[model samples]
Target: MTKKVVYLHGFASSSQSEKAVLTSAFFARYYPHIDYAALDLPYAPDAALALIRQHIGQTTEVALIGSSLGGFLATCIAEQLGCRACLINPAVAPHKVLHQHLGRYYHPVLQQHYEVTAEHMSVLEQLMPMTLKQPQNYLLLLQSGDEVLDYRLALDYYQGASIKLSEGGDHSYVGFAAELETIANFCQLA
Candidate 1:
């Protein structure tokens, strides 16, 4: 079956991110039949969820690919929509981490500035899935040497899910291109 894949970038990142671009390019080169959506999501949690849900509702066979903060959001979406997800060093408790950067920040690639406020954080708290209902519905790809988020957090949180733990790599998830085919295969039905 032709599968649909949604690629969600990190907090400060966008659809134009290196990972997003490579994901898109990979499907374009190999799996041309797939449907893909990678947007420059708004910082607000509600807005981000709305955008994700809209695209996902359009397809029955859907999978989510999220990185960092995007990984956090994907988990929420996956539970609600009953779709499978692949998290790239996803954040288990972004509220705790985001609180550290609750102010104006800039996205160099998008060339836009935004703020992370307490109100914005409240939305994040509301959306966080207290428990993953279907642990089998996920594929967690983590790098131990990540400086931004502890890989152990994801390893613990997604305990029952399929996890690929690498030795030493940064939060950006080096060598992501080599795994696109597997990601595509996971998103489809047998």
Candidate 2:
């Protein structure tokens, strides 16, 4: 059967992100049969979820690759769809983490502006899986040098899952290209 991998970019990020571009290129070059989609998600949490679901349509057995906020969204989607997901430097409890940064936010890459509100946090909280029902379906990737978020949070949160903790990398996940094969294997793209 054919496979599909939907990539979700992090908060304030676009499909043009380095990781997203690399992911698309890797799949295109090596796994030509696999459908790879990196969508530009809306800043609004609810709208983003809606767009992801709409893109997924009725397709079953889809795989997900989510970075940062995308990782958080991937977890929610995977739980609901019972699919495998590769989370890279995923945000843990973003509802709590983003509380301090609540206000108007802008992304220069997308030339978009959006509000960061308590309601968005509430939506995130509701989407969060109190406990992952199928932990084996997830692959958590973390780096120690993430300045934006503490990597330990993901380590503690994603316990009981397959995790690869690297020594040093920023929030953007340095050397991410090297892991493309591993991610593809985990998602059964091969």
Candidate 3:
């Protein structure tokens, strides 16, 4: 059977992320039988989830690979869709983290400066249900030295899920390709 895989990137990231690009290439070459999609999410979580739900609703079996904020979004989607997910350096509490992001920043790709606001943070919080209902459906990948988020938060939040901890890597997980096999295995594609 052909497997469906969707990759969702973090905030300020896009479908063109190095990890997404490499993973797409790897699957294209080695697992030609599988289907893949890389999502470029909107700045808002609701819009992103809508797009994800639409795509997932079309497939009978699916696997999700999400990074950072995308990972938090992925977990919510997986719960609703009953699909499996691989979360890489996921943000466990994005609403709280956004406090530090309340300023304007330029997006290199979009060539625009965007401000993080309280409303945006509230929207994120509203989208996330208080508790993770289906922890068993997720595989958490954490790096001890993530500069952006506290890895311990994810470790504790997803304590029930399968976890892979790397000793010293940043939030981007410096070398994500090495985890492709683990991701595939977790998704039951390996």
Candidate 4:
């Protein structure tokens, strides 16, 4: 069967992120048959999850790749959809992590602005998976030098899953290019 990969962007990020772009290019160059989509995720976690879930419903053999906040969302969706997920420095507890940004937020790269109200934080709290549902369905790529999130959180959270812990890389997942092929293989995009 043909495969699909849904890429979720980080908080305040869009489909224009470097990782999203690289993911798209990787599919275009090496796996033209795969249906690759990178979404311009909304600021509201509820809306973003709804949108991605909608896409998953229409796609074939759906798999997921989520970065940062996207990873958190992907985990929630993967739990619901029973699909595989690849998380890139994903948020462990976004409800707590995002509490700091519970106001106006802007994205310099996408030049977009949005708000994260207390209600949105509540949605995150409600949606985050309390316990591991499908541990075997996850593939984590963590960077120790992530300035945004503590890598150990993900390491501990996804201890039983397949994890790629890099020595030093920022939250942006520097050197993500090197792992594209491996990620593709893991997601069965190859």
Candidate 5:
């Protein structure tokens, strides 16, 4: 059976993120037969979860690829749905870290200032029951020089999962085409 891959972007990011776009294009060339879906999560975690659940419910074999906050969501969904996932620069402690961003902020692409509140932090905590679980089902891709998030936190959280830590790469981990192949291989797509 062909496995379906779902790509989820980070907070304030969309399906149009450079990684997402490049992933689509790369897969189109390397794994054209595999089905892929990229969702624009915006800032609605519950809505994104619902859409992901609906999509996964329709498939038997599936893989998820998520970046940053989306990685946190992907881990939640992977646990709930019993699927495998690839997490790239995932936010292991988003609730705590996001305390610095507790205010309304504008997204240039979305063209709106969205509210960031303690309630959202509560929701994030509720969504992430623990930092990590079922490590065997996960492949974590981390960069050591991520300026936004502390990569060591992810390393510690995903201790038992397969990990690839690259030096000098930022949070976005751009210009790593070979890393995509590694991720694909880990997801058993290669």
Candidate 6:
């Protein structure tokens, strides 16, 4: 049985994200047997899901690690696939939150320009799970100082799941490397 782990980056982000790169390296160095991939998801939510599906075809032993909006997508995929996931500073309700930020934007890291529209928010709303079917399958990592998002939302949304809260960390979840071991154990990488 081949175990796999996929790292999903956040909105307007890419596989080259710092966290994604670190995770890929960590998995490569420590868990050589488990296959690991961090793909650059498309800008659109639907396309992103499609890309993830295409990449993960027929893979049984899989775990997901998602950040921000990627965490939202990972939750949706994890529920559909019945896999475990680790959410880092996840966006609990990006549809409602991002509604105000609808406009053209540029990502320096991705070197791409994209637009956020009402349709995108609609798709995100559709992806939102009304209720968690398997809360035990989720590991929530939250920080108090996330300027971009309100961490309490994740705390409330993922009420029954295992949570690790940190103080004074930014939206990027400062000191993310410290949680790799816990993430590995939760995802059952061994």
Report model 5's TM-score to 2 decimal places. Answer: 0.89
lDDT against true structure, model 3: 0.84
Model 6 segments beyond 4 Å from truth? 106-112
Q: How high is the CA lDDT of each candidate model?
A: 0.85, 0.90, 0.84, 0.87, 0.82, 0.90
Q: Which ten residues in a row have the lowest lDDT in candidate 4?
A: 53-62
Model 2, 70-183: lDDT tens per residue? 999999899899899999999989898887778998777768788988898898888788888888989988999999999998888888889999999899999999999899
How close to the true structure is residue 184 of candidate 6, measured as C-alpha lDDT?
Answer: 92
> Across residues 1-190, which tens digit of lDDT does each residue of candidate 4 receive?
4388889999888788899999999889998888889988778888888889787776547889999999999999888877888999999988888888888878676577888898998888888787887888899999999999999999888877899889998999999988888888888764
In candidate 2, stretches whose alpha carbon ends up further than 4 angstroms from where it belongs are: 108-110
Q: Show model 3 residue runs off by greater than 4 Å.
A: 103-115
Error of 6 at 47 (Å): 0.5
User: lDDT by residue for model 1 over 1-190, one digit each (tens)?
Assistant: 5377889999988888889999999878877777778877778788888988877776657888999999999999889777899999999888888888788988776687877899888888888888899999899889998999999989888879999999999999999988787777777733
lDDT of 3 by residue, 1-190 (tens): 3289989999888888898898898888877788788887776677789888887767758899999998988888887777899999998879899777787776666666777778888888877756778788899888999999999988888878999899999998977898888888888775
Candidate 6, run of 10 with poorest lDDT: 105-114
- Per the 3 Å backbone cut-off, how many clashing residue pairs does candidate 4 have? 0
Structural similarity to truth (TM-score) of each candidate:
0.93, 0.94, 0.90, 0.93, 0.89, 0.94
Q: 2 or 5, which is superior by TM-score?
A: 2
For residue 53, give model 4's deviation from the true position in Å. 1.0
Candidate 4 residues lying further than 4 Å off, grouped into runs, are 58-60, 106-112
Instruction: Tell me which of candidates 3 and 6 scores higher on lDDT.
Output: 6
lDDT of 5 by residue, 54-96 (tens): 8777775888999999899899988876778899999886888
Q: How do the residues 90-127 of candidate 6 rate in per-residue lDDT, one tens digit apiece?
A: 99889988898899988776677888899999999998
